[model samples]
Target: MRELLYQINEHLKTVTFIIIRDNNDKSEAISDYNIITLKFDDIIKSVEELKLDFQRYEDSASKLAELIPRAEKPFKNEVDELKSLSIYNSNLFAHYYSNTLCNNAFNERKIVNNSIFHLITFRSIVNKSKSNIYSLVNCIKDTLFANWSFKNQGEDNPLCIEFNKPIRYYRIGNRNEEYIVADAALFNFFFDFKKALNKEQDEDIINCSSDDNDSDGSYTSYDVSRESSYENNHCKQIECQTFLFIPRKRKKRAKNDPCKDPVKTIQCYFRSKTHKLHIQFPNNNEPEQELKKSKKKFYKKIKNKVEEYKIEKQSTICPEMKKLLDEIENDINKEFENIKYKYENMN
Candidate 1:
């Protein structure tokens, strides 16, 4: 709760900015002082309350998306398709009204609630009826897209997951090396290795091929320079070096009932042509007394530091915003002058 309060303090400014920029069209700006002060408390609370259900939806959505095609007619596995769809739709209430962005400050919570509601019910998107295979396939495509979009919102590239290391590597790594693989390939559209453009796509392509999208594995490192949208939005780390290689399995497999169907294990391999990265971290060892401090005391100190940082950061709010606005205005003026200069010279 204390950590959340700290976040509320940090995010309150962004919420205020959103209201300010978006609320300007309202002619009664002077009378709208109340609208200018926005609080993300309710929004955060609502999100936290439903966070678990949203997570479950994501998991089931992935499962249904992977198997929807096989479950459709001709294959006639309607049981799986319908059951998965039922699971998906049942959770739709979790994000019931998600399509529209909140344009009104008065209804900010509504907008946020709707957006989050829409974000997690990610798989229900479809076009046309699911009557025929063509339509069903098309609709399935839509479902896949929605699921992908919600989870990997900022990813610009579209591609499937491919394996870097094969089955043997994962098997050996898991049992022997204490490194395991994911049940499925997960495409982390939020691939944030700052490098040449081509390599970024190269990086994500390998991730798209997983059976379970979110799994942990082995690490290798690569050089990281600038932070990408993924890092800035999600991670606070300044450097990057290693990546985990997770092994994936067949999406469709036999269920329990060993007498009828034998269990299967996914193969793992180490021979991946894609290069491995060598990760490094500085060993900033603390003093013995500091290291020996109680966790509660350390946490309190860190909390105080974070609070102080927020307090200091609040002072920069106006100046920083002014600087950005000035830059934009200057750029506009420069563009206008350049065009005028060109025209005058040409005449």
Candidate 2:
């Protein structure tokens, strides 16, 4: 997966047009409008086009897994191999084996290996691209939605577009203003749970650890207790931690009312009972269920996916992958410098 992302990053660097460099001096300054029209505009479009490729890669790889036999063949491997070659023809068998099938007669293993390979490859590409693209998008939003005072009545107020939604007003640093954030993100930026819990002076929290299972993993395990007498599974308890359940807001509806016709597929961040941020996204096609049960189930689903992603990120970062990524980024930086020089010289 890292290799595939490295490949995609290298490919993007070769495009030679997305680079933006500082133009601080008046003589060297590129017009903001030009920068927007070129860099920002092209980046947004490129991400969309790249998204198609990512999806295609995943689908193609999934199909590739199908080339392996649907079920395991426990008989003589030579007989199965010979039959496949004779029936599918030597050239076709060679192609299929090279692309998908392998000496492992275990169908499930073969399918899992191929499918996972492709899934990780495409996911890594999109994951890397989305982060960079969203950063640019946020910059555009901040610039277009910064705090503005209506001095001249005729002056236009800046506008911010929240994804596919209509243009809306935003006040910089204003928390009271209702804002929409629909990030198709994989994980939550864990809002410091301790800070959220420790905001007030009156509340107290307890922290604890023991001899088994939790030697290294240390996080703000919320003070989920009303009294100091509360003891954890492990007997020890330390002080100063506190938290309360933060119920997710929902529209007022009848107890029997079908889960408000499932909202659009969007990833949102919410404060959890433990005071940490968690991502939530409901599968739109899922059948409606009782509100509380349905929501709790969906929240767990999102949390599990985020945990898997973090594990993948950690395990996939080998020395070779790191070297490859460094090389690719170096090439990208070089291309960026070349483009910057060319653009400035031309201007």
Candidate 3:
């Protein structure tokens, strides 16, 4: 998957016009909006260079790993022999990987930590591209919904048509604004991971600063104890954190109401869970038993899918790195809950 993502990134960097339009329209003229220039040969060379560089990093990291007891050595060459390949100058890759390896020479963990570092860095890259991805998706959506009536383009276009619905106002940062709810949800998702990473990085910096100060024998026993306690608690949290359970919030309905419907209740539940479902419980009525049934059904469905997915993709991820990912995912889930609560209350 990482290799595939790297390939996709390279492809995106090279011949980079991605659009959704009429298949019959063969006008391949370059547009200012969606165009990037790079030869396929250059892309192959870049990948080859990356592979070579990856091996070098692996070897370097492995040698450094030998310095720490119980540290696993990094994976060796995964590169294929490719002739006449030139190195691509990528400061982002160099800077990130270099810092990941050299950030702390005294790190007790290196290879596994490096993998986790790479995973987070990958996520950061993908998060950065979310806006472009969103735009692409919107373009595809618009094309799919297009009436293609050039006679009255704006009037005929399905995308230009707007419908009224319940308004939900939410605050993001200092801005009190109204926008697509999904955009707000994605913003929260992106913000949570970034915020947690920033917080952790800041904490590490503070700890290093404190360690430097303490080397001069200015550290108190209480300060050491407090830091140790915090570290212990954090370790425990990571060890115990595997699954996150987020409860669904529902409005209270009157008891024994015949108007309550199970089908609409299930629909609403799924709709709230994901925007993919366009189910609407317009009556806003559901029996308590049916709601419970819906909750159980939802839980079971997710559990099965998660179990299958875990088994299929589990081998690539290191267990130690998986723990770190789980911790971050749990944090994101909590952040989502908080955002949901605030949004609901505002509505």
Candidate 4:
């Protein structure tokens, strides 16, 4: 029995040593540093001796059971503690090794979030959907590299790879300017990543693919050109300029809110100024008349307020107050001019 126990102890100790050495080697390779060294042989021998001692106690208890018939409570506690200690040691080793590798990868610029690679996926999907794929591709490349200053970190980490599955986008309505809806799983993934990266919700990110078409024979597509310059950034910029297309049953308009008003209803359907032309207005003369009326009303209100203030002050307004008001008016005009300049040079 003694010889059998001794041999078992020796084998267990050898196996434990091998496991410790392998773990250390793996840690070193990943971190590129030899920071941890364990005398596994010595540690394993001590653990084996404890195991052998416990086995002897178990054998003694079995023999004692025939005579006394009571549980070995003390040995059970010791064995539980030994198992817990082993787990604690393993956890400590893992924590130290993982944290080191994580820190090193961060320093080397290799541990970026998964969203960076998704931008590439965005580009690929857009390129596949477009008739002029090369032009779209070039435009995206220019925006990503030149405009937003994006840089790539190689695939040393798993986060650098594309998603495990392709995300699907569906068009919501028959309108050409409709927003696309993404699959639930894809939406969750995008939502989580955007939240983590502090990126704004982009219409392009959920763009409709040409593959999905609504019953009215229209598909939703993305237009990167329509994205605001202020909102376009390295992390949020997407290349997919085409809209998504989804199918749905025709919706019935309420009696009070009839769909006959294409001018008003179309405003809610499309996003851009160009698409607004699709909705036929009641008459061209109405718009001109409305503009003239609005301008006249604005000037009339301003003049009435100024006249009221002058009457209250008995036409003796302070010179400093007048100068201050003039300066404020000048500043407002200057700001308007600056805004005009910016808009003029936007193209």
Candidate 5:
């Protein structure tokens, strides 16, 4: 509770630039009053007296707002200045009261009560409907969207979670049975897709496949950068290296890597059951393919490539490759120790 009050007080300091007139009609900054530390004693007592619910929070928020004195004239009669001031105030409120910037705020606690209200309210509505299950799910989606919108009111890039497309609800069971059914894929959509863009230091593979939408596992990577819209907002295309291999179960690769070979010439796979690391190289290629290099040469090539890329630590070129290499080398050293013991025992 002390921390919350401290946070509120800290935030209040920034918005205390509101100009107000004193008893002598002399203009002075609101900061001169030293009202930065917001005392919530009265509000807390009021809330303690009332029932703990959405109505209580609503009343509390209104009272809290009343505590912050509004300047009759924050700026001169210039329209642009007024507009800019309004934006600044809105941003401050949005950052603290709304989830536009983050979810940690006093209003977020209020939203919890709102969510409970929505759930109970929708439960009654769903009970009256003929299709209970489907109606309940639809209500849940509606509640989530309502909360999402309420929290992100003043956000510039508000991310929305919804079905990829409208689901075609069909009647399930016999005609006499009143039950609506939709594909299970609808529920899977929320988790399988991501709307957030990857940052530069992000270690995740960039998936850049333009074509091949229906994941049959024949993956390929290409240098394609484009802009596309989702929910009417323009989003840059995913540039992660493994964006093409979404449906394929594969290990992570370096980001923005120059190598785009479909077939991995050198790869490491962990054999948990055997306690071993399987290092496959170009020499292990089947179908009697032409040998690019001997095993020693291939090992040298891999070593040189790792050194050339400076894959000793996490960097922009390959953030996660160093950790992966370390794990592989650790296992390899363990196996070498076992081999050396066996050789010594035989001698």
Candidate 6:
């Protein structure tokens, strides 16, 4: 599970770099917008295919579980693998779909001009984590649902339950504004369940070792408790340290003040959470880290190119264009209100 989490995290980092660089480059951004539209369509079709696959697997597991009697030990490994795979595919679908939404929102002229892009950027991060949690929870629910057939005597039917719903809305900084975010409830549940599962497995191992007939291996409860406690404590520390910094209006700063002169205002508006695990578990020989560093450099170049384009565009503005720009700005303000209205309705 940890490895899977790491893989998803790494994927998100790559996706972030791609998105930031692509959005920052005028020509590239246009090209990417086109490509993403096509890719998103394909991804939607792929999601349909995955849903079918999940349904088929669920049916097969249900049948198998029903055939296995209550007294008989079922093939746990096969069933578990199927459940996990279904979850992984579901998560992949969610991630790709969310990414498509993000790309579309970012590319939308109205959305970008209205400054809704800021909220979309934050939501993208939340979605990245939430998708994984949703996937795991759905998988567990499906597995348990299938197991229900085996538990009921002479029952050929399986009962399935809906997975826990995702969480949304998180307070940004110390502000009253609540940012629409993905829920982490599923992930928290999975974390606790995993810990309990590990504890049970450890007890089974100890019992096996102490038994005269069994000779599997020996593992002390002390060792298990120490490792589990360490992990729990580490996670707690990370959560305590994690914070989102949202920039609020300074004492004398006006609500309509533009963040043009000092970039500090822009910096203050953005927030990021610090993860101590990354520093503690640094990979000294990671080729991946080098690749990431290179990606960052490339993104920096792209950003510069975009800034140059913006300057050129500004300089080329004639009287007619200035009037048009003013009209567009007015339209943007109205459109922003509409977007906010829609968002509020969603809430």
What lDDT would each prediction earn against the true structure? 0.28, 0.29, 0.31, 0.29, 0.29, 0.31
Q: Tens-digit lDDT track for model 5 on 175-287?
A: 32111111222232212211111112242334444454453323222232333444244332342111112222223443534232111223321122122211222122221
Q: How many backbone clashes does candidate 5 have?
A: 7
The TM-score leader among the candidates is: 6
TM, every model: 0.18, 0.17, 0.18, 0.14, 0.16, 0.19
lDDT per residue for candidate 2 within 1-347, as digits (tens), equals 00000001121222111111223332322334212222323433443333222222222333333333333343234334434433234222122222222222233343344555475475554344334433433343333223221112221332221122111223435442222211222011011222222333222223332223423322222224332525553323332223322222122323321112111111111112111101121222111111212335444543454456468764423454344334433443444345435444644
Q: Tens digit of lDDT per residue, candidate 4, span 1-347?
A: 00000001221222111121243353232132322323434433333333222222223222322222123455344333333443334442222222322222222222122223666574443333332322322332232123110112122321111112222222325532211222212222232233222223222333333443343422122212333324643223343222212332222233433123222222222112211221223222232222223333333433554566568764424454355344434443444345334544643
Expressed as tens digits, the lDDT of each residue in 218-309 for candidate 6 is 22221111122244423332122211111211122124332131122222121100112123223321322222233333334434544664
Candidate 3 Cα misplacement greater than 4 A, ranges: 1-35, 38-139, 142-316
| Candidate 4 or 3, higher lDDT | 3
Task: Write down the worst ten-residue block by lDDT for model 5.
Answer: 1-10
For model 6, the superposed segments whose C-alpha errors exceed 4 Å read 1-43, 64-75, 84-167, 173-347
- TM-score for candidate 5, residues paired by index: 0.16
lDDT of 3 at 142: 41
List residue ranges in candidate 2 displaced over 4 A. 1-140, 143-314
Superpose all Cα atoms of candidate 2 onto the true structure and report the RMSD in Å to 1 decimal: 28.4
